[model samples]
Target: MASLAAGGVVIIGSKLIGGSWAMLFASGGFKVKHYDIEQEQIMNALENIRKELKRLEQADSLKGSLSAEQQPSLISGCSNITEAVEGAMHIQTLLPHQ
Candidate 1:
């Protein structure tokens, strides 16, 4: 099992569930790695995360002490699974139902 760096969370997937999980962790002040095989999906996920964070901030419901900008700043997108999981303390993988 891989371990995250202090306050690190690795999200394996860039779909709705994975992205949401990443945002949740980031909002809670965790360093998040948003990973996806498709770069486009990763980009989309990041954009959506930014929007959601802003919404939370505007609603005064954002988690943790970090601002929306700061929270999103803690998340990084990666295509490589190994790199994404490198220093994460927790890993969340979202898989589509077959």
Candidate 2:
């Protein structure tokens, strides 16, 4: 099984994007750090993610190999961009092309 030791950074302008990325990475056993400019956006994004996840759970399409606890533990929110990127094996930016 893949381990969560593979750390990742997700820089997003919106919480919706950040949480989606975080959930997928967490399901795949990667530790994820999500960052945005505003904490309120982060909160909103996380809420959206949870709603989607509940739907996924009902449909059984989510990364189902992980336990409930494992999923939440794999993802974290970061206010510091530099700290979020530190020691990350990969970084993905979900921002406007401009």
Candidate 3:
């Protein structure tokens, strides 16, 4: 996981898929950038991630060593796709297929 500290992940889209991925990586001690066109979506996603993390903690199903409170802190919401991708070691896109 030391490599994860050297570089972060950019997750495009703030829907369920993207948010889930963000939480997954963050729980693993990886920094995560969450991108969404709509600010509302980003806000909602953040809230959802928070709730999910708590639930995981309660269920004792959370991955990695980070606590629930610590995991969400690793994710940042970014409105700009370019900005989110910048300095990211890996990128995951959750856009729907056309």
lDDT agreement with native, every candidate: 0.84, 0.70, 0.89
Residue 62 displacement (Å), model 3: 1.2
By TM-score, rank the candidates, best first.
3, 1, 2
Q: How much lDDT does candidate 1 score?
A: 0.84
**Worst ten in a row by lDDT for model 3:** 1-10
Q: What's the C-alpha lDDT at position 4 in model 3?
A: 49
What lDDT tens digits, residue by residue, belong to model 2 across residues 1-98?
A: 34546556465565556577778877777777777888777777666766676677777787758765567666677878888788988788787568
Q: Which candidate is the best by TM-score?
A: 3
1-98: candidate 1 lDDT, tens digit per residue: 11234757888888899988987787667788888889999999999999998998999888877898898898989988888888667888897777
Instruction: Give the better candidate number (1 or 2) by lDDT.
Output: 1
| Candidate 2 clash pair list | none
